[model samples]
Target chain A: MIPVTIEQMSMRFGAVKVLHDVNLTVQAGECFGLIGESGSGKSTVLRCASLLQDGWRGRAMIGDTSVRDMSVAQRCRSLQMVFQDPYGSLHPRHSVRTVLSEPLKIHAIGDAPDRMRAALRDVGLPAEFLDRYPHQMSGGQRQRVAIARALILDPKVVFLDEPTSALDVSVQAEILNLLMRLRSEKGFTYIMVSHDLAVVDHMCERFAVMQHGRIVEVLDRDAITGAGAKTSYARELIGASLAYENAL
Target chain B: MDPILTVRDLSVHYPGAPVCAVKSVSFTLGRERLGIVGESGSGKSTVGRALMRLLPDAKLSAQTLTFEGVDLLAASERQMLRLRGARMSMILQDPKYSLNPIRRCGEQVAEGVRTHTRCSKKQARDKALAMLKAVQIRNPERVYDLYPHEISGGMGQRIMIAMMLLTDPDMVIADEPTSALDVTVRLQVLSILDDLVRRRGIGLIMISHDLNLVRNFCDRVLIMYDGRVVESIAAGQLDQAQHPYTRGLLAAQPRIGGGRGPLPVLKRDPAWSQPMEIPV
Candidate 1:
């Protein structure tokens, strides 16, 4: 079953059209990647699909319900988004416990204390971190808290926007492993956006290459290793990533 | 050939901090590129700043810190100012914050030249335009008058390079210079640096977290961890590094042909924080 779908989606900011007739379908329990450089409308697609940007044209569906028709409570239960910058996404004044429980409190979900502790453990953070502020945590620890906040509600679909780009190589490995482990245990669908081809290849099985606000090609993981990408832009991106690897 | 700069037993400690940020780091640089590779809070950038005496708040001490036989630690502030832009210069990570927002790109480059050399405004402006062209900026005249906000990120970085190289500094310390750039543009920027090092015979200290880039670009590499140099190896010999920290970092990066699997997280060892054993 398809957990998330976008058909003929178009978005314009006044005179500028950011997304042009974008379409995507994510399967249940699959990790789909959206790969592009800056200003490629990949994040806009996530925003439109998650109902964060309601001014887009065309239909976006989460499970069986269209995004426009879903109620606030239904939307909260179905999909959630994780932003690129963990430091900016989290509230500085709030403790880790407070940050995880706010979504539950807003949705009127009972047993907040138990759910918060479980969320911390699920993200591999100690229960003692509940009273710590965002500033007190490292970049990796803060990102884990952000992931916990996103998954605390048990949403069916989650969108990750450049999840580990800000982290160090070692810390990035830890976060990527944690994300993969969580997907297997919970069986939730993920839509990950990134500019790094190696990272996208590791996390996602099938990915779409976006250029100038349009998805130029969709390729499988096997295509990444082989010369199977159809578009010149996608080929260039792959070659650049490979060149960066060997550049040292 | 004699070294351009030499540092021995260098350490930095900011006020109120229990542990030193950089601990007894020692190195020697000639006309070749040296890379300092480490994660955040590993004191890689601190080493760079301490060399230039830029960290005002940090208390710095060294057995011997010399640049071309001149004692940097004992140099007065006025003498250091004269040597800064003329003999030694730095390129920051982001050109957006480094370049002045309101000044014309050409004027900024010309200002550096005029301050360093006893040149007229016209002479300084001509030298600036020539340097911009050297960095591969097409239509130098048009770009010369543009402000920082008008140009693209790649162009802005080139402009910063043009400005920094105007005075022909003998040594350049670049801190994560290409991290903010796109992969394709990163190559272009790096090649520009490579050209400068070859043509001018200037020593370079590249501070970055990217191990692959350092391995391929620099002649030597220093693997720093927790304010200490854990391993120092030739760039070509990075794969044979003996330190666990270096091996762990190499394994963490995902490769293209590598299949999907959980990457191994680095387990920190408390013993790695002990004083470094500098090779004689």
Candidate 2:
């Protein structure tokens, strides 16, 4: 059975149609990527699927169950989202311990202390980090903490929205490696949104290109390095990303 | 041809700080694109700000700092005011904060021209419109009337470029100019800068953190580490870099179709921060 599916999904903010009739499906344990320019509704798609946005018309299913039918608690248990900016996504005043344990307390998950430690350790952070606030940690460390917070619920699916854009290249490498390792170990499906074609090529198995609120093309990983893109827009995006001179 | 700007043993120290934010860094620029790349807190932006005389509170010291045969360090504030926007200008990172929020786009560009040159309002308006077109902004008439909040990121960036390049400055210091832009729009903005450099022979200093971008766009590259230039090499020859920091940075990038293993993380050695021994 497919782990995630969206059929005829559409969104509108006031008079502007941000998303057209979009359709997508992801297999179990697959990393699906959405690529586009700014204002292309990539983040909006993630927001809609993750229940962060309202008034979107369409059917979104996770393993045969409609996403809208799930309760808040069920949704929290089934899916989690990691945002773009770690500095903004994490609460500035909240300690790491509070950030991690709040979700557990809300869900009535016992053994909170042990689970918090395990979550931190899983993300390759030391246990002492729990006492630190977001300001005390570096950008990379804060991102790791955010990852731990998202995975603390042990959700089957995770939405990554430009997870490494705010970070330096070296730190981005660390975070990307950690995400890949965690997915392999836990078998969690990921729907990532990024504008970087190289990052999509490195992590995703297949990706869809969005422009003006529509999916222009969908291709596998091989297409990024080859001439498999059928549309001129996709080809232009690919060429521009590969070499700086070609974009001119 | 003479170099446009020259620096020797330049250093900057903030008040009450134990160590200087920028160590003794020196480089020279001619009629070419020079890139200064480093991670956050590596003082790349600090160097740029020092060059532009933007930092007011910080203590700046250099053995020799000159621009177009004029000593910047010894120049008076009145002299700098005349030379700033007219002779040497700076293009900041984001237009949202750089451009005045309440003003129209064309008026802001025209204001830049009017601040340095004696021109009537009509003349300045025409110059602003022409500069906007040079940055490849289609429908300059419509965009000119719009406010800063009305334009998109790419258009906003192009407008910022237009404002800075309107007066035809001899040197431009662009600090993370395209970091806020996406891949496609980034190239377009860069090509505009590239054209200005080639056609007008302007000396450019691009400050950024994207190694791949610097490698592809700039003629010469200076890799900064701990407020010092650890490696200076031709942009095309980055792979043959000898510094461990540069090699670590290069290996850390997860290239397209790269091996799906754990990427090599950067490991810093404290010895790298020490001054290099000059061979006598």
Candidate 3:
């Protein structure tokens, strides 16, 4: 069954259209990727699908229910998003315990502390870190806390926007491994948006390439890994990525 | 050929820090591209700054630091000022923050030329325009009058390059030069730098965290871990690096055809933090 779907989604801001007729769908337990450069409207699609932005024209369905028809609480329970910069995404003044438990408290879920501990453990962080603030943690540790917060609600679908772009390469690898492990263990669908072709190829099975607010091509793992993209823009992006690899 | 720059036992100590930010690091450079690859806090940027004497607050010491037979460690402020843009210059990461917000882009470039050489206003302006063209900026005349905020990030970076190379320095130290650029534009910027360096025989010190970029663009690579040079190898010989940190960094990156699997995280060893002998 399809867990997430977007049909002819469009967004405009002050006479400028950022997203035009974008469509996407993800099966249960699948990881779909959106790849593009800056100003490519990939983030707009995620925003509209997650119902974070209103006034977008289209149908975004999570299972059988449309996003627009869902209540705030229902949407909160169904979808979550992890932003690009963990440093800015997390609350600076809040402790890890408070940050994790706020979501459960808002949803009126019981055993908030236990669920918070479980979430921390799920992201491979120690329980003792619960008392520390965001400033006290390292970049990788802060990112782990961000991931823990996103998964605390146990949502059916999660949107990751350039999750590791701000991290060092070593820390990025650790985070990527953690994400892959959690997805397999929990069986949740993911829609990852990134500008890096190699990272998308690593984490996603099927991916779409966007350019100038339009979807230029949708490719499978084999096609992307083989650099067999059909469009000239996709080929150019791939070529640019490969040029660095073969720089010697 | 003799090296253009040489250093021995270079160290930098911040006032309140417990340990030296850059430990007894030493290297030599000729008229070729050399890369320093390291993670944040590994002191890669500090190395570049130490060469240029830009870290005023830090206590810098070296057994020997020489550039073109001149002692940089003993040079006075006034002498160093004359040598900065006239002989060597540094390129920072972002042009947006480096450029003056209120000044015209062409005037900034011409200012560097006028300060370094005896030239009339028209001559400096002409030289600035030619330098902008050399960096491959389309419509140089129109861009010269615009403010830094008026140009795109890529164009701003090109303008920064034009300004830095206006005096025709003998060496350049670029600290994460392309980190702010997109992939397509990054190639163009790098090629511009590459061409200028090749044609002018200017030594370049490229400091960045991207291992692949360093391996592809540089003739030699220095791998830094925890404020120490863990490994130094030729670009073609990067795969044969003996240090565990270098090997781990290479393995951590996700390749295109690499199938799904958990990337191996680097296991930090306390002994690796101690200084080691650098192999030639």
Candidate 4:
């Protein structure tokens, strides 16, 4: 397990500034959360850190090494991302074998067959799922395959961007539990971004609430569950979530 | 004090499909908010579409499906079209897919007014602007001209709500209306909807997958499983729901500061899928 850090990260798209001086430190094996409304640049933070997005004015560090200094292959081996939509994230044409084996093949890793089988097994899918296409699997199963592919490379840190948002509550519960079990079993650090405060409060140790491209408040589980948040925006969010009667 | 809508023994069967998508679903809606919730393919949205007569290919069979005392099942296509968007309307899930891509926001909202009522273009535009303002859009004039792509997701959803509420329909079926929106934005939209539902005294059927959203927003809740209503309970009393399915759904949710251990997965019982003994 390794710590991930972002320093003064700022990003812009044309005239619109999407992220603003976002500084965060996630200690080793910590499951940190980023919460906010839509367009709050939560996903942008993940993209910037995961190297999917560049040209942002900031530095991202994973462990002792700077992210910018690492090669594409090196970054893949260190950290991976699981997207929100299981339907769209997985390639429709690719079989489970291809999806799992591609990363290993790209990194020139040996033992593709055994590794692919083990990856599927890790996510609670049977070995027979390796031959199935994305179309053949259910939404929850597809998400598990996506999670398996992310862990196939055995990345130390995993970026989960609204992983359970698209799923049903029952399926969401199962996925969340699977994620927690995997984290504890493998000792992998997680950075999850979700709009559901309940999910964040359940999974995260500490979380940052973002608004207007800025981190408005950083809160712990106690702040979420105990005395409530300090900022009005955070409080308003909490109140709104608690019940519709409390909504402004 | 008549109910706005009454549904009895509604079933939907797709052609060549072995089983019906919706089976023997029944409910009655007064001038109150009713939430229909379940997992994907549980047929919550199917129930909504069957009520609207939107599913053309699917064979819909209902013993009694009436809205505002009009028989929805027996109504002719032309008659149903007139009743739709005037007395009853449906708010779709995604504004991105629902809103007209090529049309301006104001024009789309105005089109609904013109379609349902005899109004001049100027009158429709004025009413559309008024509706947009009611939805809490900051600058109706500025947003009026903006296309669907130009507006944000929250703004787009609000605009969609404005369009749906433009005709002052008696009953509105919002199917996952706020699922596409952010949490804060979702509550804002729901409050706007809540205000309209109370002030206008219109019945609302909110179809969603989120239990917390339904628990807080709706007065009553129906838990559907595999094309059947497994349990129907009051929103506030969801905690003490009777059915195993209802209890499973309630327990499955990860409450903020509730539990630290791995969440309990729903162990589905075969009996939950069997026909329920209809409550009086």
* Interface DockQ of each model: 0.73, 0.57, 0.71, 0.58
- Which portion of correct inter-chain contacts appears in model 3? 0.67
Q: Given candidate 4, what's the lDDT at residue A147?
A: 100
Judging by TM-score against the true structure, name the best candidate.
Answer: 1
Cα lDDT tens digits, model 3, A11-48, are 99989999899888888889999988878899889988
lDDT: the better of candidates 1 and 3: 1
lDDT for each residue of candidate 2 in A1-248, tens digit (9 for 90 to 100)? 13999899999999999999989998899999999998889999989988899899998888888889999999988999999999999999999999999999999999999999999999999999999999999999999999999999999999999999999998999999999999999999999999888888888999999998899998998997777999999998888787753321
RMSD of each: 1.4, 2.0, 1.6, 2.1
- Fnat values, candidates in order: 0.68, 0.71, 0.67, 0.79
- Which residue pairs clash within candidate 3? none
TM-score of each: 0.97, 0.96, 0.97, 0.95
Find the candidate with the highest lDDT and give its number: 4
Residue A182, candidate 1: Cα error in Å is 0.7
lDDT of 1 by residue, A1-248 (tens): 24788899999999999999998888888999999877789988998888888798989888778988988888877888888888899999999989988899999999998999999999999999999999999999999999999989999888999999899999999999999999999888999998888899889989999988899999997788797898999888878888888765
Clashing pairs in 2: none
| Descending-TM-score candidate ranking | 1, 3, 2, 4
Candidate order by decreasing DockQ: 1, 3, 4, 2
Please give the C-alpha DockQ score of model 1: 0.73
Query: In model 1 chain B, which range of ten residues has the least summed lDDT?
Result: B271-280
Indicate whether candidate 1 or candidate 2 has the larger DockQ.
Answer: 1
Report lDDT per candidate: 0.90, 0.90, 0.89, 0.90
* lDDT by residue (tens digit), candidate 1, B80-187: 899888899989999889999999989998999888789899999899999999999999999999999899788888888888888998899989988888765787
- Highest-scoring model, DockQ: 1
TM-score of model number 1? 0.97
